[model samples]
Target: MNLNIMGPLAVNELISMDTNLLLAFFIGVGSGFVLESCGFSSSRKLVGVFYGYDTVVLKVFFTGAITAMLGLLFFSLFGWIDLNLVYVNELFLWSTLIGGVVMGAGFITGGFCPGTSFCGAAIGKKDAMVFIIGLFIGVAIFMAGILCGRDYTRPHS
Candidate 1:
């Protein structure tokens, strides 16, 4: 008889908006602290991955992915989480390829992925500040295009 369908917690009425926001704020701060401590705020560290020098980023990400996967599996097996309720985005081949190329180029040239850029900017890195500005501009342009009713999925002929 529960009417709320926004999310698992929302549907169950286990968390209020204020509590959720507080949790998110703490989580974000904790994530930022972890990023800073791990040397993720350095462009040199990130670029080193591409130059075949440092593999810490890859190793950390791989470990995180495996941990998350196993945690999800365990939760599902224990019936603590319903895997069927998870939302999955629809796959688009062309969009995926194009976005990957764009992101890869940005990573190599600017030495900052979106999350790392945020972390770096938080610590007052000039290059990261520029990257953050560019990121916002790109997002604004994309939003404008969406607002203009342009279908991004269709391949331009």
Candidate 2:
């Protein structure tokens, strides 16, 4: 007996672009609300884990990661989703290592992760606003440097 099973509903086909955007907006707002409610929006609370005072962030992050991984594995196994269709970035060893190091350093020094910074900013925290501004400036400088380097390397004919 052959069992017919449909795997992975096509979201793009079912949802209009506007509706998708609206849903994303609502989800982001909900996530922000939850984070703020949990005190995750506070830099002091976030950095408490590093100081060995609080481990809520670490626990929640690990638990969420593990749960998502198990859910995906089960979904794939039961033919509810195709793992091959999942997006995965190509490995660039040196870039990945450098990025991780930079991000780790930033997190340690800033006392807030990007998500937490956004949440903090949402709640009118001045420090979080500064951090967010700094991030934007950093990105702008990086882009400018990249463009300059590319121009220098271009072949002039």
Badly placed stretches (over 4 Å) of model 2 are 1-12, 150-157
Error of 2 at 86 (Å): 1.9
Worst 10 residues of 1 by lDDT: 2-11
Q: How accurate is candidate 2 locally (lDDT)?
A: 0.79
Highest TM-score scorer: 1
lDDT of 1: 0.83
Error of 1 at 90 (Å): 2.8
Q: Using Cα atoms with residue i matched to residue i, what is each candidate's TM-score against the true structure?
A: 0.85, 0.82
**CA error at residue 154 for candidate 1, angstroms:** 6.1
For model 2, the run of ten residues with the poorest summed lDDT: 4-13
Give the true-structure RMSD of model 2.
Answer: 4.9
lDDT of 1 at 155: 58
* Model 1 misplaced regions, further than 4 Å: 1-8, 153-157
RMSD of each: 4.2, 4.9
